[model samples]
Target: MGSRNGKILFALVGVCLLVGAGYVVAAALGPDETTTEARPQVDGAVLAHAHLMVRAVDPANPRLNGRVYEIDGGKARRRSGDLACERVYFAGGRGICMGVAPSGVDYRAQIFDSQLRPVHEFALTGFPSRARVSSDGRYGATTVFVSGDSYLQAPSAFSTRTVIVDLRSGERVGQLEQFDVTKDGKPFDAVDFNFWGVTFVPGDSSRYYATLGTGGSHYLVEGDIAARSMRVLRDGVECPSLSPDGEQIVFKSRVAGSERWRLRVLDVETLADHAVAETRSVDDQVEWLDNETLVYSYEDDLYTVPADGSGEPQLLVRDASSPVRLDRGI
Candidate 1:
């Protein structure tokens, strides 16, 4: 009996040693590779509620064209679909993509939900350019070039029509030229009037800001959607984007006697103008990341500068354009 008891003790000690050795081997090999539960920290970070800076990459290749870059410096993933467009934006939990139809003759406006599922679509009149969605994503606006509407001498340059759509109802809101104008509180009309660069007021779908051109001059106009009317506010400003707080408007202002435009900000309350930090001439429409930082695309690369005109331009993403931030917190 004494010999049997000693043998049992020796067997239990051997099993304990084997269990300890197995634990040491597993620890050295790191976590289990089979489960996401044991995935690396970087893998989990890609799943967060982060903003995506999307842009067209590889202009020559049709297969790997557009890319969606994670804001936290994670890997950029290519977007799948026939979504060939100059710009794409997301707002109010919806994605708006503007481009030419596959037929190459008809322009198209495609709308998608947060999950990127097709929710709405429209057939536009001409080649699509810039696109903007209102803060709440209820209204979508685009600038396109129509042939007959423009002067024959400069068919493309002279004719630009801004179209606003009711995304909720999937209906057209008519061209900005159709809106009645009250310049200096009096009825204003012009046969050559044109409108582009729409910026909607936050929480107010009826109100918006846009650039109106008449008699070879551009003016900033305040628009009322329900009334279908506009009031001219200021001149020499084009492609205005309202700040997040709704207090200021940033736009491209033509430099006198030169064919160049500089980014400038206007105080909506005082109608005061101030230049942004970037000194180089900017040709594209700008977006506000917040009240302090302004973003725009320069030569196919995305850049940001301080709205207060303080810091130098910082590169946000390479080979990207149409930087739109999703106000998920709203």
Candidate 2:
């Protein structure tokens, strides 16, 4: 008697759910309603997750004089050092200009147009340091190093708060929010490797990941730029990159006394991790080509490997660092 009653109750509840779903479908997604994924609204073309180039800082070849070679080509061509990222890879054809610190300037900042032409120039008012693009590539955030007076001993130079601003308009986007944690959340101490590079939440465009090195500890930080608070994920880490589908993160880590940075993969949702590669030196750069393959730079050459770390890493260049995969206009 009890089993029969339970079966009847389940069937009635299922029927009610089906009726509700039918109503929702009929009302919400009628014949005329069209839903499109929120992507590529800027200029109609969906921007690539990352862009890269491999040409010549030095070149001497008959067939490959000085041209930008796409990574897909597996070779180089003749192109000038002044070639834009868009021209080399096929995104920003209008030209992009990178800011390089002049002989007497305080720092270097690279700026380019849609076609990658050097249309603007400026020197940072603070100490010289590192700079990188925002998640959307719409802004640039830089760390400025300054010398602080230390009466206790020898002179010392240190890096302070990071500054972020518009990459296109050259306007101040405001300073980066300092990371803070409570007893319940996670506390962090900012270090050199922390803030190495910032990556964003895929598709949504807002919220992002930041790596922090503090007090000999490194942590993965999730922050809402507009909210001002942060949550820490993993510690003793660097170079956090989001997968294209926004499902995973590939970062650099050094466990225990090991000096080498091992590539680690994490399920962004579950926060589980596994080692993918180990280079004697720090493995600072990692970008996922798809969910399964990742492209990274070690020493001067760029190599691509499976996210599972199954096969050997095939070299894409002899002397290419900072590799980001961009479309070949195909």
Candidate 3:
């Protein structure tokens, strides 16, 4: 049984490597350079209700880093400063932007203020995959894909590293890989453990949830910052984002036999989940528009659906990805 499972794991890793390589190539050969800057146009109803911070997706080249823009009161305007990123998230009054550094070869993360001015900058070890800031702007998390650095020091082609940063001092708090994990009341350790897609709890900066990928399963794990420990909650949940009320979690449910996912909402307490109205294979971490609706990017466009699993998907914004809800009194 162990040998058979091992073979399956190896096969899964190969598929993952191929997918990762394809992403790397697409990122490298980014969209053709065009003078036009991508801007987000929001639906009138959506604009009247929600304020959003989004990274514009260039029509000519959706892969290129687009300028940050804010949509409020039906007006779409570029952010004050020059902040463009591949993945972005903002909360409280701070934001995290991950993109190519000035050297152009290395990637970096920039901590910016509400005005979009970069307050601190640091180099990232690999390509940025996810970024999040706690609700109070006290801390931030980043996940990057690094090569040849699996937890067991194996010769794997790809692995992920998630780092928690203290936003106040702009210093590293700890790496998720160094934390302790428990599953089923027993210490759970594995060579293929990779962590990503962290979504901080609404009011608590120290408590959060993230996805733990190992042995062909993606488990949702609750983590503690001060304790530096995590416990497996359940399986088949990825890239979880807690609602503003923190009562529910919206995550991506992977479709079997394919690299695609469907949006699902689960009770944070009961762990019971239901699928949303969107039937497309969304690959991004979803954001809550207002607890009643969910917003996410698919194929470089942003869409919204009812959180209660009703109503059809609606196009919220065009040529936009990385949509961040701006309702946290920021």
Candidate 4:
């Protein structure tokens, strides 16, 4: 496995050097960019659980590169760094960053400890899209577009592959495609299976929830990490995010007969679904801000709504894409 990983990294580096050498420094970086020291206090119970909510500060200014910033209270605390990435997630007390390396061809996953100490790095395939960490921070998952991110047509249309990693042991837990799948108590196989938007169940590193696409349709898949297996739960589910209590999952659902997708929540045990109050077309993996509200990014800004399908979606943070609140109060 070491040799195989080395070869893959070698190939990724070669490709990036050939195609993205001039652009790697110009991408949006993960939240673990070099640190900046500033402490500003803000307010609200939503942000009270943690010390900082980290995200890319200047996603709009490519000239500034991927600079890391934190929201303390509600004010911006800028950090220093030029590292570029699309997203970052904190789990197991570690920061996992997914971004294109200096060589654009190499999608890299860089892990850092709570003190910002470097731990491990993986040269991955495709363009970085989303990064997620299990509640305990033992497991990390990332989604990358393997193809079809460009304007020019390609062989694969919007193909995505989700990779899970064991952060503590620094081992790749295998991609979602390798999982054995069963549908309706029978084995199911497909030549066109693609997965993305994985949400992990807390206190259980062995299980996760994700969106699986096959035969031109999408379904929510309940995955068993230890068994390397998956089972289809329901149709029309995309980007499932489990609530803090692990009793519910918020996701985006495709409306019937149209391309529009609305925010919705599902009761994992009862299989009951409720459409969130947000009626706009949202294409994001919504995050749970406490047990009642769901936060997500739409049009470069963050918005929140009630999980029970009650209240309208309201803006939380502007010019931010990834929003995370620490479970422990500061």
Candidate 5:
């Protein structure tokens, strides 16, 4: 019995290592990386009654993608899971914004009804792999690649663009280009380089953030659509996530030459930050439970801590992967 259990442990640990490795590679090679806002008050009555919308990927097809699940009454059951849910978020309990990975190079944004079926087949096309749904459920945004011929061997650069779509009308409002993150906006010239992990500012319609990597150094830049410009927020901000109320940003940072991932939270207004967690593997895919509590995926498990960078992180789930999604019951 002991031997059997040991094998199981080894297998699970190995899986986590693989997933962590993948994220590390992506972050190292991808574009480089928010401040946060104050959280709103909620009743204890609300959190106890909260349920979530999530993906219960069929472990049988770990690499093949996953299906969607709804967490109700502390039980996670299959809601659909057929869509390869990359981003699962809710807006006012009326609609869902999902980033679906249909293929390696392409992802689509789709809106869904309460029943978990596609409300429209082609709501937004050429959607970036990384995206988030708006708080009201009416708009969706993402980062996508703009490929072209290159004169040198520089990798392809992807532009972080926001495609605003009205869920009710099933129409794309428009795709505004936010930032050009290709090593000072270099055009693609080779197959070895690319981009990933695009996150938009929470409720901030004019701005978004992405990691731009080239020549081996990664930088995080914020995009301003109205100005048609991109600005580096911090030199090495990575794995940024907003708090539930969308006022706080949680991210990992590197100090000088150290490759260690140290988690930090910043005040959006004052730019004051509180450091919270330290991780050996690259920590990414964090979310907010409320404005006070934060959740992030580490070693194939999801853990939570205070938003102001306080306390030891408590485990939420294991055997899970990034692009972890959470609803604030908003």
Candidate 6:
């Protein structure tokens, strides 16, 4: 009986050793959590005119999370230090990176400096969708998907919450949902009102524009930061981005009966818009590479088209999104 028990003990020990070995092998083959560099291959000549900040998109898993990269002189290099984001934007020497918090369960936003080092971090209410900084780097805005509040009862239904942030102090300025909105010089309030895609005017940080989604209509609403009021300018505009010169506004015009959108450029003064050369539906807050050109992401790649509704779409950077033009010396 003693010899039989000894044989059984030896068998159990062997099984444990095999299990441990398998775990070690699996650990070695798993995805590396420490690696943050994307090392994208891009043409230097295309980016030589201006430095741009973008987030790398994983081809296999295109979640919003990725390492931040700077494209300059046709080269793409991952920013040094640890800063990975799901949505990233930089302007006027400040940047906002929204992603999952270190706890791995909640979302957060980190306000960073010109060196890409985080100076302040704040909690985010939901999944990060869009992030932007004012041209002068004085203020920032973030949009998140809040699941339970969707007016649409579909399975994929979701609502959005956009908030303005004071960049210097890293404090919450105001929530767009709480601000008063107007249409035609009268108060406009609705239970289904949702706001997103905030774009600050080029020279005026106190004034901004955003899309107000309500009653199945998307309106371009101009807002005043100090007054906490927004006045609807026009309808059918989403993700409005003003040009560097602040004369033209580029936005995504949603297609009828579809989730797709076509890029369109509008005169800020005239409010007349025309389709851009790119026929594909883009669902991004367009970025202006310059006064004459527009850049945006589609299918995990960056593309540029002329702001004048001429020229075909050109691929700018591969496997990158959240393109922020760095022309302001940041």
By the lDDT metric, which is better: model 1 or model 2?
1
What tens-digit string does per-residue lDDT give for candidate 3 at 1-330?
A: 111111112234544575365356445552343113767877655646768899988766665567898877767889855788878999988899987665545678999998889999888988778999999999999988776542333455566779999987889999887788899999887766778899999889999999988888899999999999999999999899999999999999988987778899999989999999999888788998897999899887888899999999988788889989997345
lDDT tens digits, residue span 179-262, model 4: 788899998776567788898898897789998877657889999888888999988888899998899999888777665688
My TM-score estimates for the predictions, one after another, are: 0.78, 0.65, 0.89, 0.80, 0.61, 0.87
Task: Show model 5 residue runs off by greater than 4 Å.
Answer: 1-50, 58-61, 92-107, 122-129, 144-233, 255-260, 322-330
Total clashes in model 3, counting residue pairs 3 or more apart in sequence or in different chains: 0
> Model 4: runs farther than 4 Å from truth?
1-52, 57-65, 79-84, 148-156
Q: Which of the two, 3 or 6, has more TM-score?
A: 3
Model 4 TM-score, all chains together = 0.80
Off by over 4 Å in 1: 1-50, 59-70, 73-75, 78-82, 154-157, 328-330
| Candidate 6 residue pairs in backbone clash | 43-74, 44-73, 44-74, 64-86
Could you give candidate 2's per-residue lDDT for residues 44-141 as a string of tens digits? 12123424554322212111112343344333332343432211121223222222233422233446544445545455544322344544566555
lDDT by residue (1-330, candidate 6, tens digit) is: 111100001111332343343233323432344233555558433745757899888766555357899888888877756898878999888899987666555678999999999999999877677888998999999987654543345433456779999999999998888888789988888777778899999879989999988877889999998899899999999889989888999999988877668999999999999999999978789999999999999888998988898889888888888999887455
What are the per-model numbers of colliding residue pairs? Answer: 0, 27, 0, 6, 15, 4
Instruction: Record all residue pairs in model 1 with backbone atoms less than 3 Å apart, i.e. clashing.
Output: none
Report the lDDT tens digits of candidate 1 across residue range 149-265.
Answer: 323343222256687888877789867777788889998776667687888898887799998877657889999888888999879888899998899999999888666789999
Better TM-score candidate (2, 6): 6
Superposed on all Cα atoms, the candidates' RMSDs to the truth, in angstroms, are 24.1, 21.3, 4.4, 6.8, 12.5, 14.3
Cα deviation of 319, candidate 5, in Å: 3.6
Range of the 10 consecutive residues with the lowest summed lDDT in candidate 1: 1-10
User: Ranking by lDDT, best first?
Assistant: 3, 6, 4, 1, 2, 5
Best model per TM-score: 3
lDDT of each: 0.66, 0.47, 0.81, 0.67, 0.47, 0.79
189 Cα displacement, candidate 2 (Å): 7.3
Model 2 TM-score?
0.65
